[model samples]
Target chain A: MSLLAVGTLAYDDVYTPYGEVKMIEAGSCTYIAMAATYFVQPVQVVSVIGGDYNDDFLADLQRRGSDLEGVEVIPEGKSFYWAGRYHDDMMGRDTLDTQLNVLADFDPKVPESYRKAPYVMLGNLTPAVQSRVLDQLTERPKLVALDTMNFWMDHALEDLMAVLKRIDVLIINDEEARQLSGELSLLKAAAKIVEMGPKILIIKKGEHGALLFEGENLFSAPALLLPKVVDPTGAGDTFAGGLIGYLAATDDLSFANLKRAVIYGSAMASFVVEDFGTRRMQTLDQEQIDRRVQRFGELMTVSL
Target chain B: MSLLAVGTLAYDDVYTPYGEVKMIEAGSCTYIAMAATYFVQPVQVVSVIGGDYNDDFLADLQRRGSDLEGVEVIPEGKSFYWAGRYHDDMMGRDTLDTQLNVLADFDPKVPESYRKAPYVMLGNLTPAVQSRVLDQLTERPKLVALDTMNFWMDHALEDLMAVLKRIDVLIINDEEARQLSGELSLLKAAAKIVEMGPKILIIKKGEHGALLFEGENLFSAPALLLPKVVDPTGAGDTFAGGLIGYLAATDDLSFANLKRAVIYGSAMASFVVEDFGTRRMQTLDQEQIDRRVQRFGELMTVSL
Candidate 1:
């Protein structure tokens, strides 16, 4: 089974309480492909980048087993760039700047060979763009998981709903869930959102962890405890990547399997936040991940 | 294996999005005794109330197997009364009124039998009053657990710190933990607080869940999923009661035992939030609690 990861590849200027970084390699696709590569090989990535994007970063991702055949690079255009400052709590942030650049008129093209990838992860993007990626799929993948933010619900709800109906899973934070469903209670929000489209809804609660809902069955995943979060830059996208990647590698979509995937996702996320951008994700090995996963199990284990 | 509970027994008026209730039987001691009685018999309760306090409610608590010999009746005064409105999220609230009345000049007198109790729970109240209860105890209990709020931390740091040094366990919400330790990260806060006195720390995160930290060991407990939280007034005290009660019943203080106690606490807290004041807590039976505890286990169980 193969996983198709489609989203941005951009440059980010981030400021956190620990420190600040300039022109760091970032974006949803960057994180998704990196994390997914740990469980599945040749993460087929489809996105648009600009000439300003660093070649070394591309080489780094390629070495980690990402297929970049579908990435459209504009010769003269600048890459998408964003600057943000995290609040002291790290849960909230203020976006200082966002430059669309090459992404303004972007069109995503799915590589013909990647069209049939069984696990497709549509990272945070314009809902219309997410829907277009689904159109290019040769067949309906085993799981079409989309990650979106509150912006889509506010400005492009109709388009978002269209994409929601087509996907098998929706992964959004608690705030996004409330905005989309107009319900404050997460259980109520999950119920209404599942009815709207996807059968499975995951409400991510940053440090608090995530809730998975499939009809009457619900699973809660705890976030790995950390004394400090150096930076929270790509945690969510990394989580989505690790999740879909595990599902693709194991080729299992059972609810039980999804729970394991969430733990793997959370484990990957815990690493990403330990450092700015994806530094920690790049350096961690399978053994460290296995131990982290075990720690997660231990964190919630109790003999009663 | 006896447990002593000391705090205020009062009347509360609460408003939530669901509805509003006025002059209901509410207080830290009331919730604690009710939840603790399920696990430990003759929960020795020591608190001060007034002539205006409902006698039937006290009789109801007594019926639940609480030993109320230490409760003081101030016939000339009125019971402590609180009025508050919960925010839409049910996490934040605004205090509309607080009349300490009888609690203003309270001096707790631990009963002779209760003075020798091995397990003790100090609910939220003036640090001076809580210290008075400890002073009257015949000997140091096996485990002295204290619960306090930010108000005490802000107004009586000297007295609060003095009480902190005497307790084996410190159970407080995330915000109060941060406030007391002056650290934004909970892990850091737990580390700082534990050094201050308590050997074990439990940081409760209302709907998010609870965390237990003992030295280098840590445990995370997931909150039960509810469609709606009717009211969250006494959830914390209920959690403290359930936790201490379980410890007293089993007479175990191992980290593993503490973890199970946390799960029991979380289960009890979950029920408290289902209805306003103690309405839900008063009606729940042991069978329901057992099922809820099993649910807590299932909520965090992941077969990785």
Candidate 2:
């Protein structure tokens, strides 16, 4: 099964309590595609990157089963860049700078081969651009999951709601959930967001864990608590990518399968945060992933 | 098996988004004894109360199999009183008033019959009072769990550390754990805390859930999501009470049994938060508690 991943590809400078890394390859799309490729081949890439972007990274994506046919190259233009410093707690951060270059006018065009992809993961972007992706698809995807942030909810909520009606799943963090639903209680917030459209909603709570809501069913997934967290920039996007990729490969949308998928996705996210800027994702093998997931299962197991 | 519960008996005026109540029955000892009575009878209560305290409430505790012989009543004195207002999110609150009338000079005296009890639950109190209770014990209990707060850590660090070295189990909220161990990471904090004394440490996260750490084993229990939380008073004490009560009744301290006890404690805490003060605890039956715990098991179940 093929999956279409539409989002940004950028260069990031990050600072954490452990150390600092500069000009690293990072973005929602980069993390999503990398995480999804582990579960399904040919994760079609639908994003824009400046010519200055590393050619070696492109080769790396191709080697990992990512189709670059849909990726647009804007020569003489700079890629989107962001610089941020994480607080001591590692849960909060401050954005030092943001330079939207090629991404300022990104008009995503889905390649013909990707239009009929079985799964789609729309990483954080403008709602209008996200809706454009859905409008170009020739065949309905088995599952369409969208990841968003408080930025879009604040700037383009009307358009966001328009896209919300077209997707099968919505993934966002806890604060965004509260902002979207205007409710203090998460249970009440999930109820309100599900009414807006998607059949499945995943609310990610950074270190606390993630909660899944489908109709009357609710699943709470516990996050694996690591002794150290190097970086957490793309943990949420990686979680979404792993989730959709698992569903596409298994082709099961039942609540039971979704529960397992949440655990798998959480397992992937746990690995991403262990190192900076998708470093852990680079050399991960199936044996390592399976072992990590087994640990997650053990971490949550309790007969009573 | 009998359990000794040493803490304060008081009245609480609480305000929540749902509504507000004035001078409602509340106290650490009251909630602990009431929750523990579900599993073990003759929950011996050691607390100081004023003549103004309700007679009906004391009679109610007796009806629920609580031994009031250890509870000292001062006819001319007033009870400990507190008033607080919950913020919109319900996780935070500001204390409006505190009147430590009878509790100001409380010197807990464990009764002769309760001195040799198999289980002891030391609720939030002055470290000196808690230590005095422990000193009065004629025999070492099978399990001793102590619940404390940041106030004691800030004011009575030496005494708190002294008491910490004597308990078998230490239960405190997440923030308190961080403050006590000076570690932001809960896993690391738990490690540092176990070295200080207690063999088992439980970190309670109000709405998020609870964590149990024993040697190399860790159990995460999810809090039941309630659509409406009237007030969250006495939740932590209730959790500790349920846990100790279950252990006392079952007489099992194995790690596996502790895992079950966490869930059982979490179930009782979920019920107490549904209404103000101890209204829900006043009317809970064994069937209700068992059913609630089964739901907790289902909430955390995932096979991957």
Candidate 3:
């Protein structure tokens, strides 16, 4: 089964208490596509970049099994560039700059070859962009998982809800779930959010872990405890990518499989936060991933 | 194996978003003894209560299998009284009043029979008072676990450290662990805290769950997702009580047993927050306790 991912591709500068980085290869799709490739081959990317985008980076993604047919390059404009500084706690950050040069008038163009992809991951993007990717798809993918942030909830709620109705799963943070559902309790928020759209809700809590809710059934996945969080920039997108990628690989949509997918997602995010940007994410091996996944089981299991 | 608990016994006035309650049975030892009796026999309590303490409450505790021979009556003073208003979150509270009448000058006197209790639980109290109880014991217990809070860390670091060195296990919340260890990351905090004293460290994160760390070994427990948190007043103390109680009942001090104890502790705490103070904690039967403990197993288990 093919997996398609649509989101941003950019150059990011992250400043954190652990350290700082400049001009790292980043963006929602960059992390998503990379993480997705770990479980599924040929992660089809539909994103926009500019002439400033590194050709070597594109080549590297392709070499690692990404289909970049729909990744448009605006030769005259600079690529999307973002700068952020993480607070004392890496849980949050302040966006210093978001220069959406090539992405300003961005139009998601799905290649015909990728239009029939059976799995689609709508990474954090404007609701309109996320919905547009679906509109271009030849058929409704077997599973459509969308990731969004609170900015859209604060600004484009109507648009966000429109996209929600068309997706099967929604992967957002706990805070966003509360804001969108107008409920303080995560259980209530999950219930309210499911009624609005997406039957499956994955509420990510930075270090605490993630919660998976489908109807009355609920599963809590603990985050892999890292010795230190070097950078948290793309941890969430990487989590979503690994989740859908594992689902796409296994082709199992049962609640049990979804639970396994979440564990895999959590394991992948553990690697993402280990190093700045996608440095560690891009270098992961199956053995390393397997060990982390195993650790999650051991960390959570108590024979009682 | 007998389990002993020593700490405050108070009348608490709690106000929350759901509603408010007048002076009810509360305090560290109250919740501890109540939660402890469900897993172990003869939960021995050593504390000081004023004449205002209800005789029926004492009889009720005794009826529920608590040995309150060490609970002294200070007829000249009022019982310890605490008034707090829980914010909407229910995870924390603002202590509006803490009129420590008898407790201000509390000098715990452990009964002769309890001096041989193999399992000892030192609930949140002045480190000086907790040490006094241990110093009065004729024989050393097989396992000694102490639960403390941020207040002690702030006002009596030396005293807190003094007690830490004498305990076999330390059960405290995430915030207190960070404050005590002077480390942010829990992994690092666990390592630093263990070096200072106890070999086993249990870090409790209210709604998130708890972490059991012993040397290089670490286990994560998920909190039972509640429909709504009615009150979180005695949840932590209840958790500690359940942990030591389970440990004492099993009579195994292995890390594996400690891990199971943490889960049982988590299950016991799930009931504590269901209602204000110890209202829910006091009424739990063995069957109800078993079900919640089983639910925690199911909740945390993911067959990978």
Interface RMSD of 1: 1.2
Per-model TM-score versus the true fold = 0.99, 0.99, 0.98
Query: In candidate 2, how many Å is residue B276 off?
Result: 0.9
lDDT of 3 by residue, A82-187 (tens): 9999999676789999998998899999999998899999999999999999999888799999999999999999999999999999999988998999888898
Q: Model 1, A189-256: lDDT tens per residue? A: 99899988899998899999999988778889999888889999999999999998999999988999
Q: Tell the DockQ for candidate 1.
A: 0.77
Better of 1 and 3 by DockQ: 1
Model 1 segments beyond 4 Å from truth? Answer: none
Q: What is the TM-score of chain A alone in each candidate?
A: 0.99, 0.99, 0.98
Which 10 residues in a row give candidate 2 chain A its minimum summed lDDT?
A295-304
| Model 3 spans with C-alpha error above 4 angstroms | none
lDDT of 3 by residue, B43-158 (tens): 99998998888899889999988999999998978999999998786656799998989998898888888898889999999999889989988889999999998999989989
TM-score of chain B of each: 0.98, 0.99, 0.98
Residue lDDT tens for model 2, A1-304: 8899999999999999999999999999999999988999889999998989999988998899899999999998999999999999897999999999999999999988889988999999999999999999999998999999899888999999999999989999989999999987889999999999998999998888899999988888888878889898899988988888888788899999999889878888999999999899998988988998888777778876
- Candidate 2, B102-138: lDDT as tens digits: 8998988778899999899999999888999999998
How high is the lDDT of residue A192 in model 2? 94
Extract clashing residue pairs from model 2.
Answer: none
Model 3 docking category: medium
